[model samples]
Target: MELQFFLPMIPPTCTHQEKQVSVVTGKPVFYDPPQIKAARSKLTAMLAKHRPERPIKGKGVRLIVKWLFPKGRHQDGEYRITKPDTDNLQKLLKDCMTEVGFWKDDAQVCSEISEKFWAAIPGIWIRVEEI
Candidate 1:
């Protein structure tokens, strides 16, 4: 089975973990930044709406993600081959998909193809399928 979806928003890169001394516990704690939490929440909600009625489960699943960024220095339809790299953009998305039951778990996704491009329309497109 294969599932495809488009999310209409500029995807944010994974937020780095921040360590701070807890006021109550007096111990260092790691937490997601408020902005990152909000972004992940939005992404999660978007994925949840598009998730398959029943989650997919199997060995060797493949994931494809295409990110379209609004034109800035790059022209419309240009391949965004530079920064705001793929892995960073993928981290939150894959995690969100896993949370929303896109698959039994992200570990089952054995193959991945992710790309970014400059487009007049900005959005993220994703596909999950059994291989």
Candidate 2:
């Protein structure tokens, strides 16, 4: 089965790698900052409406996500090769997808294709399929 959808909103700038760390009780603790928390919340809310009836399982799932940001000085549909690495962006999105029941675990997604672009219409394009 394949699930695909487009979410019309500016993709979050904050990535999962933005997690903050602190020393508490002489131990290291990791936490998300306010901005990161907000990003996650927004992503979760948007993804909730697209959740699959049953979480995808196994290790043969494929996920394709395209992040479209506002076209500032760049041309529409042009690839954004700058900051907020693709892996970091995918991390946060996959986490939210998991939280919203897109899959039993992100590990089930063995094949992934992620890209970022500067677009006239900002949004996220998501495609999930079982291989």
Candidate 3:
């Protein structure tokens, strides 16, 4: 017996009304105090140990972590950090670069390193909202 797969059809009117739109006029909010603190702490720890030849540039790992795990409102309507399951994220990044021969023998460009690091992990997402 042969099986057939049918694609679902979406109505034009339904599609048109399903889209969401919003407008706001104001300055963008910055990171929360706790978040900034956590990021700084983590960055400091990483820097103290690694001591890369060049500066990490921009917000460095902390900014990347924030992007990876955004903040959202909780049940009490209070904003909280949506932490990422970075378990072994660092080791995985290093392994990936080594396997790809990008950093097999020595250090690579900071941009390349960051790119490879982010690529190793999938399904990680982050978004920050002001309290």
User: Which predicted model would earn the best lDDT?
Assistant: 2
Q: For residues 14-75, could you state the per-residue lDDT of candidate 3 as single tens digits? A: 11112243444654533325433443344334333333334322321321221121112223
Clashing pairs in 3: 70-126, 70-127
- Sorted by lDDT (best first), the order is 2, 1, 3
The residue-level lDDT of candidate 1 at 93 comes to 79
Tens digits of per-residue lDDT for model 2, 1-131? 78999999999999988889999999999999999999999999999999989887764789999999999999999999998899999999999999999889888889999999999999999999988
Which candidate model has the greater lDDT, 1 or 2? 2
lDDT of 1 by residue, 1-131 (tens): 88888889976754433323354567665667777788789998888899888777666689999999888878988999877778877777788888998888888888999998998888999888888
Off by over 4 Å in 3: 1-25, 54-131
- Evaluate residue 121 in candidate 2 and report its C-alpha lDDT on the 0 to 100 scale: 98
Q: List the candidates ranked by TM-score, beginning with the highest.
A: 2, 1, 3
Error of 1 at 8 (Å): 1.3
Worst 10 residues of 2 by lDDT: 52-61
Backbone clashes in model 1, listed as residue pairs: none
For candidate 2, the lDDT comes to 0.93
> Using Cα atoms with residue i matched to residue i, what is each candidate's TM-score against the true structure?
0.85, 0.97, 0.22
